[model samples]
Target: MKTKDALYNYCLRLADSNMIHGQRLAEWCSRGPFLEEDIALSNMSLDMIGQAEMLYEYASTQSEAEHSADDLAFRRSEREYFNCLLVEQENGDFAQTMMKVFLYSAFAKQLYESLLNSNNETLSGFAAKAIKEVKYHLRHSSEWLIRFGNGTDESKRRVQQAVTNLWRFTQDMFEMNDADAALVDNGISFTTEALSAKWQLNVNEIFTAANINIPETNNTITGGYNGIHTEHLGVMLCEMQYLQRAYPDAKW
Candidate 1:
């Protein structure tokens, strides 16, 4: 990447999104619908956190800043985070959470699939490995969405509501900032607009089988790229960052 800062920022965007989403999934550690599902969510949480760590490590190598991966992962203030609005959303219910994951995983699958050929070797390798986990996540979440859609009346009601409530944030996932434009121009990153189009197709295919209707509109909620997040991120960060903040140098 010619502009190191742009590449670094892009990596932070990817890592921050993964870390926050993983933390949200970890909230279901003991609260999944069943024991098997509980274990599944925990595993997914680990997978996302691991991905985040790898991305952070790569970013650290590229950055002149002294922030370690842990510092980058935990020390940044809320406004410094560049995650999409989708991942940081509050987990509403079983259906809502699954829908959220489905949307993100679908995007990740296509984004990484294209990134396998990135000019940046570190990013290309990361995409190759991360795509596998993303595929499983897409499959898992899509299956649950189908089940919820075809199940009892209440199940159908809840899942549809999840779709309606979360639809706006979906558009924000593709909203790119200057750093993203710079990386894309330099071939260090893929264009999220193209990725977003593919993601919508995948989402439509799954939603079709589930008999769920997608709301069509130009009204999209964004600003996460600009570091403006919903109230949910602040809450999650407070809880997740408490230990690190309380003892800045705490070590095991």
Candidate 2:
């Protein structure tokens, strides 16, 4: 693949994942367990969306069609989105939500940190800005996970179940594809293997402290990089793109 095409897909993968994950987190608006948490989730959702917008903007510059960031985000079909399957999973419960947050933030933090060293200036700058946000995200979710683990029987049971259910999808986050390979060759990105190893170490420490064991699951679900997502993503896009699709170029 040409470097420009590779870069565009790389940006789309990151942007799409952030965009979808932000939308999922946005669902908690006004529904958090408490006022502070509600606001926190909203703020985090904004952070993710803002990052996605910036990435989408850069991606637009690389496209021959000269698509806008909104076009890239709101006009894409489900098969065109490259977000990881892990981010597209339903937010089952507060515990389930936090598990997803903790896991994704852990991986994101490492990914962004490594990107800080990317040969691409734009990506490195994005990484510098994003690392700060993901750090806070990791801290907030990690503390919450620990609380759930040690708080009560119900909390423990719920969080434990969430871990078991979500563990299978975690492997999907580390799946590298052709775009990733091209980016790595050009020093624009790093290997998922190293990222996964660091992610696992950090998660292990937190899980050990939280009294939550990593599930012993041999099954792994992937293919999101290749645009093969769970049914959840298509449903999500229908709702997310409803306004854009129903009224083309409509604006507030």
Ten-residue stretch with the least lDDT total in model 1: 1-10
Off by over 4 Å in 2: none
- Report the C-alpha displacement of residue 161, candidate 1, in angstroms: 0.5
Give candidate 2's whole-model lDDT.
0.94
Pairs with backbone N, CA or C atoms under 3 Å apart (clashes), candidate 2: none
Write the residue-wise lDDT of candidate 1 on 1-252 in tens digits. 347988888899889999998999999999999999999999999999999999999999889978899999888888999998999998999999999999999988988988897999999999999999989999999999999999999999999999988999988888888887788787878777778778879998999999999977677899887789998898888998898999997999
Clashing pairs in 1: none
Q: Which consecutive 10 residues in model 2 have the weakest lDDT in total?
A: 175-184
Per-residue lDDT tens digits for candidate 2, residues 19-106, read 9999999999999999999999999899999999999999999897879999999999999999999889999999999999999999
Q: At residue 61, what lDDT does model 2 achieve?
A: 96
Query: All models: lDDT?
Result: 0.90, 0.94
Which whole-number lDDT from 0 to 100 does residue 201 have in model 2?
99
The number of clashing residue pairs in each candidate reads 0, 0
Q: Against the hidden reference, what TM-scores do the models get?
A: 0.97, 0.99
* TM-score of model 1 vs. true structure: 0.97
